[model samples]
Each structure stands twice: as C-alpha cells, then as structure tokens.
Target: MTWTLVTIPASHYCDKARWALDRAGLAYIEDGHMPILHWRAARRHKGTRTVPILVHDQGIAADSTDILHVIDAHVAADQQLFPAEPALRARVAAWEERFDRQLGPAARRLVYFHLLQDPALTTDVVGSGAPRHERVIFRGLFPLLAGLMRRGMNITPAKSAQSREKLQALFADVGAELADGRRYLCGDRFTAADLTFAALASPVLLPDGHPVIRTAWARVPPAMQAEITAFRETPAGEFALRLYREERRASGL
Candidate 1:
C-alpha cells in the first residue's frame, strides 16, 4: 500500500521527513496544505497538529522524528538515518534534537517575520504545492491567515532578533563540531543530525538543491537578503550547503 505524507509545502520539518523517506526509497504521495489548514489534515489522521505525518499500511507516524524512526525500521542498516552504534546514535539523537528544538523554530520564526511583511510573497512561499483551490483561497485570505500565523508563532520583532542570535550560536556550534575537518557531522557518514540542521536551516539559507521552498533571491527583501548572504558565508552554513549539494539524495549508497 502507498503511504501518504501530510505536509505544509514550505515547512522545513516536513522537508526533513521527506528527505529521510526519499533516502529510504519509499514511495509516498504527499498531501500538501497551507499553514492553519494543516491542522485539520493532521486531526483527520489522528496526529497532533503538525505537518509531515506519515500514514502507512502499518500505522501513522506523527512528526518528522517519528517518520525517521519508521523509515529506519524499514531500510537496511547501512541506509538508516540513525547510527547503528550506541554512542554514535546517542550523539546523533542529541544533535538532531537540539536542531529540532532550537534551529527549526527559530529559523522559521525569523523567516516568517520577514516574509509576512509582503502578503503576496508569503502566499507564494507557504501556499505552494497545495491544491490550486487552496492556493487561491489562501491568497484571498492571506491577511487573515498571515495574522493568525504571526500570532501562533509569536513572530514579533523582538523574537525575530532573538532567533537571529540563536541561529548564530547554533551555527557556531556546528562549525566547532566540523573544525576537525570531518566530512559530515558524525564523521564521513551523513546522519539525521546533518539532515535536520540542513533542512531546518533551509529557510534562512535557501540552498540550491532544495526540492521546494525555493523563493527567488530577487523577490526577497533587501534586509533579509543581506542576512541570508551572511549566513551563507559561515562555516556551518557552508557545511549545510555542501550537504544539500552532495548528499540531499534518495540514497546514501
């Protein structure tokens, strides 16, 4: 039976789940939705209000982390997202959790703070990949939806500034981990840690290889574009971009 992935077309967390599933060679149809609209979809699947809920023959995998575990159980050991070794697996989990807790929300808030300033751009970015009717409805109701999103996410200027600081700190942490000249976050092999960070950071960096969420550079506001450029120059940023270039694929092999 084919799996169905519930997703917000522009959500980085959804991208993380998509990346893992693709790498595992799983074929699934994605049911894409807009921001507030995704809650209804999630509820229909008996999942918490979040995108990237994977509905398979066996069961429902709620959230990106759960989706990864489901994929890991199905794939070969070598192709798993988590390391087979205990210590290494713990380290990967720690890193993945940190990025999830810290990077994902912060990056999302910061970008939304900027993107919401222009209703049209916001519609194009977040409303993408949904059905045409949804897109049209979203565009018409963007003012209301954007307000709801800002309030739900608490995307104030102060919070956006705080998120910027958090992003810098997390980037520095990644850079320190890579200072030893290791190819990937956990040595030569790419793991969930790397995937999580890269996918979560995609909104700020907009790396070339992303499947969705590729808003044109010209369309971005000047201030936001400057920040993206600065982020792209960092060691951590470089690392994430490289992973997108070389390893954001359907299989590690």
Candidate 2:
C-alpha cells in the first residue's frame, strides 16, 4: 500500500517524520492540512488528534517517532534511524526523547507566542501548504484559532518566558556536546537525535529551503530577533542549519 503522511506542513514533528522517510528513500504522499483542520484528518486516519501520522496498508504510525521506527523497519540497516550498535542506539533514543519532550515543545511555544500576535504572518505560516479555501478560512477564523492554540499550547507570558529559558539551556547543552568536536549528537554518524534536533530547531533557525515560509527575520520583534541571531551563531544552531542544507535537500523529495 502507498504511505500517506498526514501533517500540518509547517509542523516540526511532521518535518522529523518527513526527514526520516526521505532519508530512508521511502515513497509517500503528504496530505497536508491547516492547524485545527488537521485534527479531523488525523482522527480519521489513526483515531488521534495530533498529526505527523503515517498510514499504510499494514497499519498506522500515529506519531513522528513511530513513523521513524516504521521507516527504520522497512529500510536497510545503513539507512536506519537508529544505529546498529545497541549502546549508541540507546544514546540516540535518549537524546531523541529529550529533544522531543523539551526542545520541540519549547520551540513551539516560543514561535507561537510571537506568531499569535500577528494574524497575517500566522496565517502565512499555517496556510503555506493548505488549499486556497482553507487559507481563506484560516484567515477568517484566525482569532478563534489563535485563542484555541494559545490555550491548548499554554502560550502565556509566563510559559513563553520559561520556554525561552529552556531553549537557551538546551542549546547550550547541545553546544557543549559538540564542543568536543563530535560530528553528530550520538557519534560520528547521523542518528535520530541529530535529525530531531535539526528538525525541531528549524522554527528558531529558519533555515533556508524549509518546508514552511517563515516571517522575515527583519520583521520579527527586536528582542526575539536578537535571540534568534545569537542562537544562529551558536555551534549547535549552525549544526542544525548545516544538516538542513546538506542532508535535508539531498533526499530530493
């Protein structure tokens, strides 16, 4: 059966799944949707309200990580997300978990906190891969959608501040790990952890050729732009950008 990846298009988690599938050379169709509209599609496919869900003839992979595991199972060993060595694979999994639990949410909160303030840019970001009618609908319902997203994602002043701090700390940790001059997060080779970090960090880095069309850096709030500039200069952030420029496009997807 052909694989269909249901996604919000600009979602970092969805990017992770996309990267994994592409890296594994798996052919799949992307069924993209706008924000809240994706919940219905996700539920129809996998009985879940979140996206990055993969559906195939065999069954459904309801999460990005699950999709990566599915790809790993189908692909050759060398193309697997996890390393062959057990210990290294464990480290990769642990790092992937850390980034998924912390970096991903923190990045989302930070980005949404700012984007929610500007309806036009928010629409642009969310409507990138959606149909024209859906884009118009999103613009029309943006106020309601923004409110729901803020509440559901807990994007308050306090949480946004906390998310910034968390993101800085995590970036510092990643920089420290790379300080020893290691090529990848877990080892010399690319692994799931590196992909997770690069994909999740895309919101902040706004690497060129990203699936999403981000607000211009010049138009960002001064304070946020400063933070973004600093992060982009960091070793870890550079690593993520390099991964996107080198690995992400190489798949030719």
Candidate 3:
C-alpha cells in the first residue's frame, strides 16, 4: 500500500513528520485538512487521534515522533536521523522530549498572545456547537481544537506576560546553544532532535516557503515582526533555517 500523511494544514506537529519524510526522500500522499477533518481520519488507525499519523504498508504508525521512528527503521538506506555519536544523540533525544512537551507550549502561547488568533475548533470536533451537517459527517471524531486554542492563545494580559517571558528564556537558551558554529541542532548531522525543535520553534525561526510561517508570524505588528525576524537571522535561528533549506525541503526549500 502507498504511504499517506494525515495532518492538519500548517500544524507544527505535521511539519515535523513532513521534515522526516522529506529528508528520507520518501514519497507519500499528504492529506491536509482543517481541525475537524483531522479527528475523522484518526479513527482509521490504531492508537492515534492526532495529526502526523503515517499509514504505510506495515499497518499504521500513530504519533508523529513514533511515525518518524518507524520511518528511520524501515527506510531503504541506513540514513541516520540521529547523531552517530551515542552520548550526543542521547542528549539530543532528551532535548527533543523537552522541546516537544515543555518549550512547545510556551512558544505556542507566545504566537497566540501576540497574534490573538484562536480559531476554537474543539466544539467543531466534539459536536458541541458545530452545524448539524458537520456532526453527521464527523461522527465519532473528538477534535482537540479547543485544547489547541487554549495552548495557542493567552487571552488574559497576565497569562500572555507569563508565556512571553517563558518563551524569551527558551529562545535565549536556544540562541546560546547555537552561539558557536554548529550547523544542525545535534552538531552537524541532521537528526530527529533538530527536526523536532525546528518545526515547533519555526514560528520564531521560520525558513523560506513554509505555509505557517507567514500566517502565524506575519499576524504580528510590523515592528515586532522585524525584530523577531532579525532574531531568527541569528546563529540559532539561522541553524534551523539552514536545516529546513538543506534537509527538510531539499526539493523546494
């Protein structure tokens, strides 16, 4: 069977999976949809109600990171997404976990606070306030849109300040780590850790031709955009940008 990537358009989760598939030179169909459609597709697989699920001949791989793990194992060539250096690879993997779980929330909140763009999709998924027609079509899919929205936006001023400060600290660490001349996050070779960090962190350090970069970051004011874009031009952000250029989107980016 052919491989397919089921995901929400412009989702950083989806972007991470895409980065892996693209880097591996793997061919797959991309099933792009809004928040509601994502849940509908998740039921077809086992153990997944999230985007970036990969369905290939070897049954279905749920979870974005899990999907990438499977891809690294099954690809024809022994192309490594992890560093060959064992200690460094382990450290990078630890960083990837934190970035995916912790820093990800803060960074997402920063974008939402600055943009105020919360398209609350939970109701649409769970059949709360959505149209009757949508409920019928959606069936059992419970959308996580609201949770995503809550993570994406900080409505109260206090919350926004807290999230922004957290992100500022995160960025400083990332910048400091890249203060030296390492091209990739794990120091030279393209690895899963870098891909995870780059996709989630892309809001601040966006590269060329990414769909979300324009909508997410551009929503900010001109002066602020300029400031953030310049920061992205730094060694850390530049490292993420180069990874997207040379590895993630080698075909187009």
Candidate 4:
C-alpha cells in the first residue's frame, strides 16, 4: 500500500520521518499543510494533533519515531534505521530521545523567534509547499498565527536566549562525541541517531537542498548568523551538513 505522510513541510520532526521512509525505499505521498491547518488534518487521521503522521494499510503512526519503526518493518534488514546489534541499537535510541527532547524544541523556538521578526520571511519559508489557499490564509492571518505560535511555543526573548544556550551545550556534547574520530554516532554505520540529529538541526543549519524551503543564510539576523556560522564550523554541525549532502542525495527523500 502507498503510505500517506502528513506534514507541515518545514517541520524538523517531519523531515526526520521523511528521511527514514526514503532511506528504507518506501514509496509514499507527502501531504504538506500549513501550521494551524495541520492540527485539523492530524486529528482527522487519528484524533491526534501532530504532523508527520503516516497512514498505511496496516495502521497509522502518530509520531516520527513510530514511523521509523514502520519503515524498518517494511524494508530489508540492512536498510533499517535501528541497528542490528543490541548495544548499538540502544545507544541510537538514547541519542534519538535526547535530541528529540532537547535539540528539536530548542532549535525550533530559536529559529521561530528570529523568523517571526520578518513577516515576509515567515510567509516565504513556512508557507512554502502549502496549498495556494493555505498560503493566502497564512498571509492574511499572520498576526493571529504568529500570536498563537508565540503563546503555544512560549517564545520570548529570555526563552530564546535560553534555547540558544541549550543548543550550544548539546552541540558541544555531540562535538566531543565525534572528537574520537567515530564516523557515526552509534558506530561505523549510519543509524537513526545521525539522521535525527541532522534533521532536527536543519532549522539552525539551513542545510542546502533540504526538502523544505529555508531562509537564506544572509537574511538571518546578524547575531543569529554569527552563531549559525560558528555552528557550521563545529564538528557536529559539519557532520550534520555532510549527512545532508551525502545521505539525503542517496535516499532522494
């Protein structure tokens, strides 16, 4: 059966799911939606209020990690996101959890905090790939949408600052891990940990050729651009970018 993956298009979490499905060579249709409208679409599918939901003949996956498992089941053993070795699989899972909880939210809040400052940038990046009507609605209701997003995500100057600190600490940790010259997070082979980190870091890294539209590096605020430049120089950030260049092209996700 053809899988239908619902997403906000620019969401890092959705990209994670899309990458895994593509890596596993699963044929699927992507139904991209705008922000608030995505909640309704998600609810219609499984009474859940989140994107990156995957629907197939067997059942529906309401989360990105769940979608990874579904893709794993459908693909050959070598194509699995989870490692075959028990210890390596456990390590991959642990890293995925940490990045999912810390990296994803912090990067999202930090990026939105800056992007919301420019209505045009917000519309151009977030509304890209959405239906024309949805894009129009986003432009018309930008104020309300921005307000709701700020409130829901608790985006404030102080919170954004805190998120930047969190991101720095996480990147430092990843950098230290890579210092030993390990090719991948878990071991020699690429696994979900690498995929999760790279995908979730897209907001800050603005990875080239990402499936979603991204703000130009030059357009980012001066301070934010400085930080992004520093991040791009870090070992962890370079690793993420390399994954995008090599693995993403291989998967064609």
Candidate 5:
C-alpha cells in the first residue's frame, strides 16, 4: 500500500503537511476528508482524532511536524525546506512550534468566533459533512462546528490573550526580519517556516477568493480587517502572500 497522508480539506494543519510534502517533492497518496470517514479509522488506531495524520511505511506519523521531519530526513538533500546550517535549522524549527501552537490557535479562535456567525459559510461547512450541525442543519448529522473548532485549544481567556499577544509580538519580529527585504522567511529561498507562517496566518490574512471559506470572516470587523490588511502588507505578511501565490501556482494546486 502507498503511504497515505490523511488530511482535511482547507484545514490549516493539513495544509502544513501538504506544504512540507510538496516542498520536499515527496510522493504520497493524499486522502482529503470532507466526510472525515478516514479520520475515524485514524482514531481507532492512533488513539487521537486529528486530521493530517501520515501513515508511512514505518508507522503512523501523527503530528504535522513529525511527519515533516520524517519525510525531510529522507530528502535531506533538498535544501529548500530546512536550512542547511545548524543554527538556522534550530531557529526555523523553533519558529514552526511557535507558529503552530501559538499563532495558530489565536488565529483559529479569531476566525471561528466570527465564522459561526456567517449564515452562508456556516451552511456551506455543514453541507461539507462536519459530523453534526447546531440547529437547522441538524436535519441529519451532528451539531455545532463550534464544538469541533474549539476542541484541543483548551483556550481560556488568559491562554487566548497570551497566544494573541505572542502571535502579535512574534509577527512584529517577523515584520522586522522582512524589513531588510529578504525574499523568503530565512533567506532568499522558501523554507518550511515560510509555509507554516503563510498557511497558518491565512485565517487572519485570508487569501482573496479562497474556495473553502469563499467569504470574508464575519467576525473580523472593518477596523480589524484593516489591521489584517496592514499586517499582510508588512514585510512578513507580504512574504506570506507572495509564497501563497507563487508556490501555490507553481504547484498547480
């Protein structure tokens, strides 16, 4: 059997896996979930319910970063993903953790809180077979995307604020880094760090006409929307934007 990458369509975490695998030029069968039936199979074995689980020849690689690292080792010759320098590699790895765990959650919350309000988008997601629905769509399956979105974050006010602050501060640093006018996150080349930041930050600075959501998140007001745009214009966000367009098009995804 081919090694399979189980992912959820439009999931940022899933995008993380795809981004890594694509950059490494690794060939793996991708299983994208909308009904999420394969995810149930993963839960049965992996003992956790998460998308983007990789079933490699060795074993089940559960985490996005873990999967990336595993594939990366095999393709170590590919210098585009991770930096060749030890110090740069360390810094890039650290940024991956911070972005995935910190900025990821805050942006998720900021978007989810608002997404639940958009009637059209909500209907679309529910129609995507999200296991359940809150009210009207409870016509058949489960209920509430909110519950699904909220899971794993364990977000309290304190934690949420902390993540938000860290995300803002970290992005500020990234902005400063890009102010020197580098093409990618680390140097003139695209790295895993760039992919992580761009993919994770999409909710805050959503790509125009994204097919999945297909609309501006209703939660973000015009003022904050402006802030998001400004952030996108920042050196860091600009890099992210360019990467999204360039890499995405180059891959023909």
Candidate 6:
C-alpha cells in the first residue's frame, strides 16, 4: 500500500516524521500544505489540527511520535527507533519525550518570533514545496495568518527571550550528558532520542541542506544568524548537526 504523509513541509515535526519514514525505507507521497490552511486536510484526513499525519493502508498515524512507532513496526530490528532491550528503550523514550516537550516548542517559538516579523521571508520559508495555489493563498493572507500564529504561539519578545533561556538550560543538560564521550544522545548508536533532538533543533541550528534550511538561511535575519552560530558552537548543537550530516537521508517517496 502506498502511504501518504501529510505535512507542512517547513515544519520541524513534519521533518521528524519524514526522517522516520525515510529511515524505515518506506516509500510514501508527501502531501504538503500551508500552515493555517492545513487544518482542512488534517480534519478531512481524520487527524487533529497538526501536520505529519501519516495515512497508511490500515489507518492514520496522527502524530510524529506515532508515525515513528508505526515505522518502527515495519522495519528490521536494527532500524527501529525504539530499542528492543527494555532498559535502553526506556532511556531513549525519556530523552525523546523531553526533547519533544521542551526543545521543540522552545526552538519553534524562538524561530517564529523572528521569522513572522518579515512576512515576505516567512512566506518563502513556509510556502516552499506547498501547492502553487496554497502558496499564493499563504502569501496573500500572510498578515492575518501571521497574527494568528503569534497569538496562538505567544511569539512575543518576552516569550522569545524565555524560550532562549529554556533552550540554553536544555542544551546545557544535553551537553553535560555527552561529556562522557558518548556518540549519540542515549547511547552508542542512534535512536529516537537523537532523531527527535536533531529534528527539533533544526529550527535553531539550521543544518545545511535541510528542506526548511534551504530557503531560510539565505534570508535569515543577522541577529538570528548570530544566534544560530552560537548554537552551532554548543556541544549539543554540534551533535545534532552531525546527525543531520551523517544520518539524514532522502525519503525516496
């Protein structure tokens, strides 16, 4: 059966789902959509108002983490995101959950606080890979949508500063975990923990050649770029980027 992955192409969580599908060597069609407009598709597809909904033969996986579990079920043991050993799996799950709950939102708010200020640039970033009509709609109605996003995500200057502080603390913790010369987040080999961290961190780290990074970096604000540089210098940031460089692969869909 041909799977269909619904996504807002520029979204980090969507990228996380894509990476999971790719790692599983599962072929699927990417149904890309715009941000606010994606609700229609998500609702029609029987998912919550979120991207990265994987529609498969059996049913739909409504969340990125759910998609990973779905992909893990079909792949070989070695390719699974969750380890077979109970202890290792628990550790991996803990790290993945922490990154999802903390790192993901913080990175998103910090990045959007800057990107939403420049509608044209934000349009380019969010509209890329969307259908032409959706892109046009997004560009035309960006102001209203941007306002909704800011309000919804609380993307104020104060909130953005708070997100930065949160990231600093989280990254420090991740760095300290790596102080023992461990290669990956949970252990020696890659797991859901590493994937979640890298994908969530992509917003701030902007590792080269990421689907979202391609259109964003060229036009990133100077202040954001400087912040990104600082992130890249951190041990955790370096680890995420390294995973992107070495582990990220084409979906082949």
What value of lDDT does candidate 6 attain over all alpha carbons?
0.89
Error of 6 at 17 (Å): 0.5
Candidate 2, 12-128: lDDT as tens digits: 998899888887878888888989978888888878899899997689999888888888898878768798899999999999999999999999999888888888877777777
On residues 1-253, what C-alpha lDDT tens digit does candidate 1 reach at each position? Answer: 9999999968999999988887778889889998887888999997589888999989998879988999899988887889899999999999999999999999999999999999888878787788787878888988898889899999999999999999999999999989999988884698999999999999999887777766556688999999999999999999999988888774211
Give per-residue CA lDDT, model 5, range 71-168, as digits (tens): 77767554546777888788788888888887777776655555545555544542342333322443233344445545645445565556556667
lDDT (C-alpha) at residue 164 in model 5: 58
Better of 3 and 5 by TM-score: 5
Runs in model 3 with CA error above 4 Å?
Answer: 76-78, 114-148, 151-156, 211-227, 230-234, 250-253
lDDT ranking of the models:
6, 1, 4, 2, 5, 3
TM-score per candidate, chains pooled: 0.96, 0.95, 0.75, 0.95, 0.77, 0.97
- RMSD after Cα superposition, model 5: 4.2
Q: Lowest lDDT 10-mer window, candidate 1?
A: 244-253
- For model 4, residues 183-231, the per-residue Cα lDDT tens digits are 8888788889999999999888988857774446767778778878888
Query: Over 4 Å off in model 4, which ranges?
Result: 250-253
Residue-level lDDT of model 6, residues 149-234, one tens digit each, is 99988899999999999999999999999999999977678999999999999999888847655557768999999999899899
Score each candidate by Cα lDDT.
0.88, 0.85, 0.64, 0.87, 0.65, 0.89
TM-score of 4: 0.95
Best by lDDT: 6
lDDT of 3 by residue, 51-71 (tens): 778888787877777877878
Off by over 4 Å in 5: 34-39, 123-145, 151-165, 208-227, 249-253
- Where model 1 places Cα greater than 4 Å from the true spot, the runs are 250-253
- In model 3, state the lDDT of residue 100: 82
Q: Give the local distance difference test score of model 1.
A: 0.88
- Global CA lDDT of candidate 2, please? 0.85
- For model 6, what is the error of residue 211's alpha carbon versus the real structure, in angstroms, after optimal superposition? 2.7
